[model samples]
Target: MKNPTNGSLAQTFQTLEEYNPALNAGVEKVALVLQTMALFFLIVLFIIELQNYAKKLNSDDGGLTMEIVTSIGMRYLVAFLMVMASGEILDFIMWLAIQASKWVSSVLPEGTYNMTVPGIKGKVGFFEKPIVFLFSAIAQLAVWTNSYIATIIIFLRAIQLFIFKALAPIFVVFVMSEELKSIGIGFLKQFSAYALQGVVLVLLMGIYPALMQNDFLAGDVATGMDAWLTNIGVFFLIFLKALVVLVLIIGSQNLAKRLIGGG
Candidate 1:
């Protein structure tokens, strides 16, 4: 499969915003089934609420009244409508989050990271400087590996968002009950974390180019063996920086959660 993240930073964000695993026919069918089941459960819960209210009506306290009954009915009606439109609601949330991140990224200097292995100008004399050659090879491999892993992480995050979308209807039902509201709130927090993760990733992308521009490297001029050694060292440093970027990207969801006070 083509790497979805193999694109400009803006394109990557667009891909994430547009991702919908339920576009697959099988997944669509499963989501529909889940939605239908949720609707059924919602109806059952509403009936149970009415029964409990009726019991309260029969009590001497007379705490429950017709207005409260109407309020309960209206609450379920709204929940039912929200469950029916859950997909649209999720899409809107994702779009809003991605757009917010994009706006934030726009304020930063514009640049892109080339995740591909940096090309070496001359062939390495493997017999003479074996350790340099080995380090050079390792750095190139690390760059390629980082690119591959970043693509996989983006793809997996899309899948996670899809799973959250599929379960949204069920969670909407949870929100209808005071006893289960926390469960529903937890689901929303996690969904928000994944949704807002792009913010951190975009910010990192915006900052990476500036981070890589070293004054010492910018002014340096080397010749002969020194030049070759310098290139190896520079590539190794890039690999190290790329490794740190990958770590930050992987932890982005947690960072998002913390930002939203989900922790």
Candidate 2:
């Protein structure tokens, strides 16, 4: 009755606070390493291509027309600019997705409720206290699940940001070469879908809370057991949807390739 979850719940939340930041920092370090490698590979590939192009230009059928030369220069210039502004561009795109998500959530019903015992200082019976405590714990579990989902959304967006930033040059080169253009288009499709994942997750998170709120209100008036069971069911559904979002994001690259006629 007197804060049944005092030690364990405090420890759990404390652990979350300590580890989430560590996990985020570690992921960023790994992302930076990968981004460096991607940049290196792009440079190597560009140099090799440039040499080959020079040899071709010196041949009898060589020498690019002003139009072709200008087009190629412009394409590389675009690629250069994109790579330089990749971070800002990515941030802007992510901001837009978050804004869209906020707009959608604004239209949905609010999903807020309280699940706690009130005035329990020698007022309620000892037996009733434990029961209320149990319900309160369950409600807290629901709250934790929501926070976990939000953490996942942040992690996913971090990953997408890394991918886009690391491959900004590659994406730009897609416009320069006909052979690699489809691959680039596929990459763009993949990027767009990945960005939308945040929106999808935001919307999904909103929906479950509303349903839980309805069930919670009804269950309070109806029966504690009913509300508990229904809330659990709804949270399970939310977990499953979260898994599906992860799968879709992971498999999006191949799907994008297929969609853009790339083998």
Candidate 3:
């Protein structure tokens, strides 16, 4: 029985040894085919990009050959520089926002204070307590909304970093072709606008810290029902401001596209 077991083990090892080369060969073949396909695709893209260059050169340019060539060259040069310095340039832009945010953070704790309704101090009516609580809940909701917006902005910035900086070389190729250069320039402008939102958000955060000493929803409970009512009104106005900020952030890319002459 031991001899049979040993023979079986040997057979298994031998079979595995025999299969290794075939498995490796199959993997290598697949890799080679995939690499070839990728090469073919890149070549196609290169051809298309070159064709765009040719089309632009042949376009009616009021016989300004040297000027057009020089302009295109300058643009490509700038694009090359951006590609090489993509990480550094973007990091610097982000650093500015970080610094601004830090300044805002230093001011935030000092600005916040406990919610108080001076109107409800002496005689608390039946609905007065509930109204105060309601206003408090609304204040908490506003804070939560701001947090949510900040999180979304951060997530979008991460995506932009990955797409613009990581794949900058690919985008740079687009910049060399007149037909595609607009797309490239437009993309860059849009990304810049997106990044600039961080500054705007920081400024908004700074405003409250500098101007507001306490929650806008906080009011004198002793002032009776009018206190919470005033807080709700203030909350709505602040919420409107938040909505405006969101709209600006979302439409920033379009604004950039126009500024860059994208359309």
Candidate 4:
């Protein structure tokens, strides 16, 4: 049997990008039905807007002018086009975000130190310094747990992107009315934030290596007890650093949201 954990982080992300549960046949059919219903409602909204314009024309306000009609018609037309191409637009946004993240990672300085549990284990002798070995093992576990959590968050974000893609048509209908345009704009902002989460993750990953490059416990220890104490302190510091990185990775979505002015 194939081991699920054998996949690298990059492979996991690639899989997530390719996965599209929102495009399931049943979901697509449901979205189409909802889109049809929303289009009908859009038509009703446009008619109501025209009626308002007519009333204004009868009044001294002169809001029933050609410019107003043209604006309303344009809004409805744009909304219609958006609803039709919602999936493609969302896909493009996601692709753009992934590409941006890859570019950022490519530009960042690569770290020389091995931050993995196995890497740490290889550095210390298991039998000679059992206490230090224990610390390294614990650090390894912590690193693995942190990585797993980050992967889960990224996977969920991918799912959210697809869900947004599937529902874009309905939310975009709000753009047809001036009063409800903010709702549509808010949806787009939220989607953009989620899409940008990958970029935040890439940045954190790129920076983490540099932060962990220096070995605080590099020198030889004078005594066994002293070595144990020193290794323990170093391990504690390592844990603190790893914890900070993990927290940032988990909160990447919120960070992205703030970056894009999304609530």
- Residues 83-132 of candidate 1: C-alpha lDDT, one tens digit per residue: 88876777777887877776776576544453344445454455536666
The 0-to-1 C-alpha lDDT of every candidate, in the order given, reads 0.68, 0.48, 0.47, 0.69
Output the lDDT of residue 2, model 4.
Answer: 17
Q: Which should have the higher lDDT, number 1 or number 3?
A: 1
The lowest-lDDT stretch of 10 consecutive residues in candidate 1 is: 1-10
lDDT of 4: 0.69
Candidate 3 lDDT by residue in tens digits, 1-263: 01111121112112111324564345434433444443443345555645566676568453435565576567656655555554455456555545544454355443331212212233445665576556545645654465455556545654554455444444544555556667666666665655554445444443532333343424443455465556555555544555555565455445544654554
Candidate 1 stretches with Cα past 4 Å from truth are: 1-5, 8-11, 15-28, 50-60, 115-130, 215-218, 222-233
Top model by lDDT, which number?
A: 4
| TM, every model | 0.78, 0.51, 0.52, 0.82
Q: Which residue pairs collide, candidate 1?
A: none
Per-residue alpha-carbon lDDT of model 4 for 1-263, expressed as tens digits?
Answer: 11123233343234233664435444456567778877986898899889977887878666577888898899899889888876667767777886776677567764421355323322334455777777777776777777778778877876777677668888888876877889888988999998888777766765665666554535554454355666666676677788888889888999999999997
Error of 1 at 263 (Å): 4.3
**Clash pairs (backbone) in predicted model 4:** none
**What is the per-residue lDDT of model 2 for residues 1-263, given as tens digits with 9 covering 90 to 100?**
01112222122122111325665455445445554554554555555656566678878577756675566656656655555554455546555655665566567554322222121122334445566456445555545555554565456555555556555544644544444667656665565555555555445444544544433343332244444344444445444544554455345445534544453
Q: What order do you get sorting by lDDT, best first?
A: 4, 1, 2, 3
Please identify model 3 stretches exceeding 4 Å from their true place.
1-85, 92-123, 209-263
Least lDDT summed over 10 consecutive residues: which range in candidate 3? Answer: 1-10
Question: Order of candidates by TM-score, top first?
Answer: 4, 1, 3, 2
- Kindly provide the TM-score of model 2 when superposed on the true structure, using C-alpha atoms: 0.51
